[model samples]
Target: MTEGRKMRFAMVCSSNQNRSMEAHTLLKRHGLDVASYGTGAHVKLPGPSLHEPNVYEFGTPYKTMYEELRRKDPDLYKRNGILPMLKRNLAVKNAPQRWQDNAADGIFDVVMTFEERVFDMVIEDMNNREQKLMKAVLIINLEVKDNHEEAAAGAKVALELCKELEATDSWEDTIDDIVAKFEREQERRILYSISFY
Candidate 1:
């Protein structure tokens, strides 16, 4: 929370593929220390269908998933850009790890989630580990649409909020406003199309 010290951040999503990874990649590139995780039991992504999604488990190496995907449907996998996303997932080494797995003291100064479910999961996990988890860590949820374009936009908003958090001396006053702004951004996005693709 102090301006002089580096703020550690953790971004969580359902699959750790789209949203959180986008935020994680950009935040790290901009010199913020960040890590990403997922609250899902397994990694599930849009693929053929709900019955046959790209399902992977935590601790399952990204390379394994990529190979499996390539073997299952090479053409479709290539068409959907899953290969690059897999590579990025592998680079980060975070696969749908449950929030409970990320629990630790002083591990994160700020924990941000891309969805309400994940935010609840993190809080529930933290509550269960009240003795071990850091009490001072700030948890914020910013709803992010699950798509490459939206994830990129969400990442920028996250970066802006992170910088603002660093500059502020009091979080109690600005925290609610920050969350409201994030919600407003989501609403404004729902009625518009910024995509060129």
Candidate 2:
């Protein structure tokens, strides 16, 4: 890519609260120029002061994950704090809509949908002339399995789909591996070209 022509990516997930937020953090940490949005509009972006509805319903797992992220890296909070600064720098009041009426006007080089249904919807739209390209990838996260064997099987399938979309890697076998890949590749403009199902 040229100096100004970085590959942009957008990740749309079921709930922006968990997986998508994690993915966003991972991508940015790796130095990829990426953005993430949630299908469920109410999900809050992860941050020190962020709030979410029914947060109590999610319980310990959510809290544990959030705390872990904070403990592992204090910089997430600082990076997230830059969102407001962008508004001031650009003089734009509000960010762009998720689905712009004019698909050609959008900025993402690749658009990924986490759920199968969302992937199908995006495909259907492409068929209906809603999007200009049909290069979207569907990323499916299988049920949490007890062993690496099961997880690897699921990840293999997911990785194949990414490969078909011309993604750089065939699969990210583990969460830690995925996180590490993101952290190590921050200087290059690599998008975490994935969707969840």
Evaluated with TM-score, which candidate comes out highest? 1
List of clashing residue pairs for candidate 2: 30-186, 31-186, 114-196, 139-195, 139-196, 140-197
Q: Model 1 reaches what TM-score against the true structure?
A: 0.80
Give the C-alpha lDDT of model 1: 0.71
Superposed model 1: Cα runs more than 4 Å off: 1-4, 94-96, 104-106, 132-134, 169-197
Error of 1 at 195 (Å): 36
Across 82-104, the per-residue lDDT of candidate 1 in tens digits comes to 87778776786634455567644
TM-score of each: 0.80, 0.38
Q: Write down the RMSD of all candidates, one decimal each.
A: 7.0, 12.6
lDDT of 2 by residue, 1-197 (tens): 11332455555545433333334444555556556544443433454554522222221243443454556554853365323322221231123223323354455545555556555554454456544345443333323232224323433433332333334332333434543554364321222334321
